[model samples]
Target chain A: MPTGAEWAIIALSLKVAAAAILLTLPLAFALAWLLARKRFAGRMLLDTVVHLPLVLPPVVTGWLLLLFFGQSGAGGRALQALFGTTLMFRWTGAALAAGIMALPLMVRAIRLSLEAIDRRLESAARTLGATAWRAFATITLPLALPGIGAAMVLGFARSLGEFGATITFVSNVPGETRTLPLAIYTALQVPGAEDSVTRLAIASVVLSLAALLVSEWLVRKGGRHVL
Target chain B: MSFDLAIEVPRGDRTVSVTIAPASGITALFGPSGVGKTTVLDVVAGLVRPSSGHVRVAGETLFDAAAGIALPPERRGCGYVFQDGRLFPHMSVQGNLTYGWKLAPPAQRFMTLAEAADFLGITALLDRTPRTLSGGEAQRVAIGRALLSGPRALLMDEPLSSLDENRRDGILQVIERIRDDLALPILYVSHDRAEVDRLAAQVVELA
Candidate 1:
C-alpha cells in the first residue's frame, strides 16, 4: 500500500546503492589484492587509510567528503572545470558518499578471500609457463568469486541504509537525492507520520533480505567448485 | 636436456649447499628431510634464488650470479610438480592441462593437449575437477599439466608421497613409462630410497 512517492524513494535508494557498488567494486578488488599479496613500503599505511572510514565517526567522514567535493573545494573546482558536472547536492553525490562509506567493507571481504588462496598455486602456474598476471587471472580471481559476491552484498546493504553521508553531502532533495532512509527520516519529523515510518522500515528490511538472498545465489553459482 | 645447478641456501642456523650436474635422464636428489633436496629443485625451477651459483638447463643458462642473468619461472621452460599436486582447483582436469598449453608460445607448443592427457591416462577425467581426483590421479594430472607447457626439463618434489602403497606403485609405473617414452631430463626429489632405485637413472645423495 505504498504511495508513488514512497516507491520513488525506494527505487532511488536501490539505484544509489547499486551505483555505489558498481563504482567501488573494481577499486576495492585492486586495493584488496595489493593489501593481501604485495609487501611494499607504505602498504600498512595504505591499508590503514582504506579502513579509516570504518573506525572514524560517520559525521566526521561526511564532513571530510563535504570539504573534498563541495563547490569551494579544490577537487570540486577541478572536476567542474574538467567535466562541467557538479556533484554537490546531487544524486550522484549521494552515491559517491555511500560508496566511500562502504569501501572498507568490500575491501575487507575481498582481502579475506584473496588471502585464503594458496600462493604456491601461483608459483605452480608460473612454472607451467604462466606470467604473474596470467596466474592471478586464471587462479586467484576465480577463487575469490564468493568473496567478491559477499563484498558486493555488504556494500549494497551499507549503501542502502546510508544516511549521515548522503544527508550531509546531498541534503535530501526530493526526486533527486531523497533516498529511502532520507524519506523515512523526513516522515519521522512530520505530525501523524508514524504509519508511513512503519511502512518504510518494512521496505528497508525486505530490500536487505532480498539483496542477501540474491547474493548467496550468485555466490553459489559463480563460486569455485569443491568436492 | 641437461641440468647443472649449484645452490647455497641459509636455513636458519644451517646453510645448505647442493649441486647436481646430471648429464641426462632422470636424476634423483635423494636425502633425509630438511637436507635442502627440495631447495635444490627450487633453485633449478627458478622458485628460489641462490646467494652464489648458477643454473643451466638444456644448454641455456637460466641463472648466473656472475653473469647477472636470472630468468623468471615462466621463461625458464622448467615444469615443476609440487608435492601437494597444485592443480588449479577452479579448472577441470582438461582446463588445468590446457592452461599451460595455451600460455606456451605457438612455436614452442610441442606437446598437444591430447598427447599430455593420453600420456598421464587422464583423458577420462578431463571433465572432472581436481578436488574429486585421488592423490595419484591428481599427481598424474599435475604432471600432464606440466608437460603441456613444453618444458625443457621436469622437476618433481615428492610427487607420490601422499598416495597409498597401491597408488604409489601405480604412479611409479606411470613415471617409469614416462621415463622410457620421453627423452626430457627429469630431476626427481625423494626421501624414499626405494622410489629412487625404482626410477632414477642417476642418484645424487644429499648429506
Candidate 2:
C-alpha cells in the first residue's frame, strides 16, 4: 500500500470512530443516569447487558451484532423494511460495533461521577421552584458535565482502537470498512511488509497518544471546577 | 402564613409524631439533636411525605392524606435553606440567587434578581462561583436563592449552625432583617436556645 492509502485508512478510521462516539454519547449518558440516579426493577439486568460487550470475547460480541443487525436478522430486516437502511458490511456497521464495545466504559465513567453528586443540591433546586426536569438541566446536568466530557473522550479513544468487532461485523474492505487496525493487520500478514508495519505502528501510537492527551487536557480543564 | 400539621414519620426504629399549628411570624422548631425538628420542617416543606397525615398552610392544602392531595416540594412554594447551603457549584452567585426566581411563574415572582442580591449583600460576588466562596458567603447565597424563589413560606433548617461565631452572628442579623423585611412566614429549625431566644416569636419544642 502507498503512503496515501495508509493515510486514507487512518482518515476512514477516524471518521468511523467519530461517528461511533456521537452515536454512543447520549445513550451512554441516559444509561449512566438511570443506573446512578433512579431505582427501578431490572436495573441489574440492564447494567449487565450494557457490560456484556466488555466481558464477552470481542469476536463473540461481533458475531452477536451480526446476528442481530445483519440483513436477514429481525433488527436488520426491520431497519431495511422501514427506513431502507443496511448495516451489514458498511461503515455504519463498523460504528455500531465500536459503539457497543465502548458503551460500558462510557457509562461507568459517567455513572461514577454522577453518583458522587449530592442529591441535596437537586433537592435544594427543587425548593427553589425548579421542576424536576429543570433541576436536572440546571443543577445535575451541569455538575455531571466534567464526567460527560471524560466519557466522550474515553468512548472516542475506544472506538479508534476497535478492531475485532469491526472486522467480524463488517468485514475488512478498503475505504469502505477497513479501519486503521484492519489495515495494520493486513500489512502485517503479507510477506516483505515489515516496513509498512513499522510505519503504521508508529502512526497508530502517535494518533492514540494525541487523542489521549486531548482528552486528558479536556478532563483536567473541566475537572478543576467540579473538584 | 401559618400551618396545621400532624404527622407520624418512621425514623429507623422510632416514630416521630409531632403536631403543632404555627402562628404568624417566625415559628422556631427548637429541639436538641436527633429529636425530629428538621423532620417537621421537612414535612412542612413537602420534602417528606408522611405515611398518613395532613399539612394545611394558611387556607391552602399542601398535603392531605385524607384528600389524597400531596403537593411535591416545588409546587408547595416553600423555599428551603439547608444547613450546608447546597449552592449549585456550576453557577455563579448571581445565577444561584436567581435560579429559582427566574424559574418562578410570572405572577408568583415577588423579588427581582437585583433585589435578592442586594438583600443578601451578595451583589459583589455575583460573578463568583460557589467554589471560591467562604462558608458564610455560601449560606448567604443559599438564603438569597431561596428567598428570591417567591415561595409562599420559608423553611430554614439550621441555616447558621455550620458558621463560626462571627458568621453566625452575621447570618442571625440577616435572618432578623428577613423576618422584618419579608411578609412570608419562616419555619426556622434550630437547636440553639440563643437563636430561639433571639429570633423566634413562637417556639415549638420537639422531644
Candidate 3:
C-alpha cells in the first residue's frame, strides 16, 4: 500500500476542482450571456482572449500565472495587503490557475447553448410582463441549464488534470497544494513508486470519464425542447 | 383609452403607417408579407420602435415621441404571440401558463392557471414540456400564457401562420372562443385574408 498520502491527494484534487468550478460559474454565465446575447464591437476579441490559454502551451500559461500572482506582482501584492492572504504556493492559487485554464472550454459550451436559444421566446416573456432581467432569470437561465451543467462538469474535469499552471504557480507543495497530477509526477520520481503512480493515474481517468458522462446526460435531459 | 395607436415604420424601401382607434373587439392588421403587417404589431407591443409615432393603450400613453415617453415592452401590458409558438422550453405546460400570472398586477389577474388551461383544453398536458406538444397545442399554450398576464390588449403577429391548414382551423376556433369569452381588445396580425375574415371583427389595412 502507498499509504494515505496518495488517497489524500486524489480527494484534495477533487475538492479543488469542484471549488474552481463553483468560483468560476457566475463569471462564466455572465461571459456566456454577453457573448451569446450582446452584439458588440470587441466581442470577438474578448472571446479570443478567453480562449488563449487553450491553445497556448500549458507551461507557458503556468509561467504567466506565476508572473501575475507572484508575491511581488500588482494583484498579488494588493490581495496580500488587503486580506493578509497569499495565493502563491497555496491550494487556492492552484484552483485559480486551474479555473483560468478551464474557462475557455466552459465558456464555449455555454455560449453555444445560449446562442441556440430563440430570441422570440424571450420576447414572448417580455410581452408577458417580465422585465428583461427577470425574463432571463426565469426563462433564459432555466433554458440554458443543460449547457451550463455541461460547462461546469467540463471545467471541473479540466481543473483535475491541470498540471503546468498548478506546478508553476503553487509549486506542488506536499499536503497543501500538491494535486493529483503533481502527486503522480512525484510518485514517478521516487525509487520503486510505480504502484502508487498507477493507482493515482487510474483514479484520474475514472473521474474524468465520470464527469464527461454527467455532461452528456445533462445535455440529453436539459437541452432545448421548444423553438 | 381603449386603443389609440398611430405608427409609421420603415422596412427596406417601403414605409408602413396606420392609425387605428379601437373602442372594442378585435382589430385585425391585414396586409401582404413585407408590407409590415407584423411590424405594426411589433410597434404596438413595444418590440419595435416606430420611426415616428404615438401609441396610447387603455388611456396610458405608452409611446409618445412628442412627449419623449417610450414605455418598455413589459410595462406596456401587451400580450404578444409570434408566428411561431414561443413557449418556454424548460418549463412544464403548467409553468409556461403561469409565467405571466406572477407579473400581472394583483387586481388585474382575471385569468388563473387552471382557468386558462381549461380554456385552452390543456389540462391533460399540464405536466408535459413544450417539446412534447404539437403545433396547435403549443399555440394554445402560448395564448393561455399571454391571457394569464391580464393584458389590457393582445398583440398577435400571425399566431396561426406556422400551423398546417388542418391545425390552423382548430387553433382559429380557440382564438374565436377566447375573443368571445375575454373582455380585452385583441390586435390580430395576418397576411392570410381568410384567417383575418374568419377571426377579426374589424380590419385595419397596413401598407
TM-score of chain B of each: 0.95, 0.95, 0.93
Model 2 lDDT, full chain set: 0.86
> On a 0 to 1 TM-score scale, where does candidate 3 land against the true structure?
0.94
- Candidate 3, residues B29-96, lDDT tens digits: the string is 88878778877878888888998889998788999988899899999888887777778877888888
Ranking by lDDT: 1, 2, 3
Off by over 4 Å in 3: A224-227, B12-14
For candidate 1, lDDT tens digit of each residue in A77-152? 9889999988888889999989999999999989988888889898999998888898888888888888898899
Error of 2 at A14 (Å): 1.3
lDDT of 2 by residue, B1-207 (tens): 576678888877898887868688788888889998888778877778788888877667998888999988888888888888888887888888888888789898878988888887888999999999999999998888888888888889999888889888888888888888776788899989988999988888888
Ten residues in sequence with the least summed lDDT for candidate 3 chain B: B1-10
Q: What share of the true interface contacts does each candidate keep?
A: 0.93, 0.87, 0.98
TM-score of each: 0.94, 0.95, 0.94
DockQ of each: 0.79, 0.80, 0.82
Candidate 1 lDDT, B132-186, residue by residue in tens: 9988899999988888888888899998899988888878877777677877788
Model 2 chain B lDDT-worst window of ten: B1-10
The deviation in Å at residue B4 for candidate 3 is: 2.0
List iRMS (one decimal) for every candidate.
1.3, 1.0, 1.3
Q: Please list the C-alpha lDDT of all candidates, in the order they appear.
A: 0.87, 0.86, 0.85
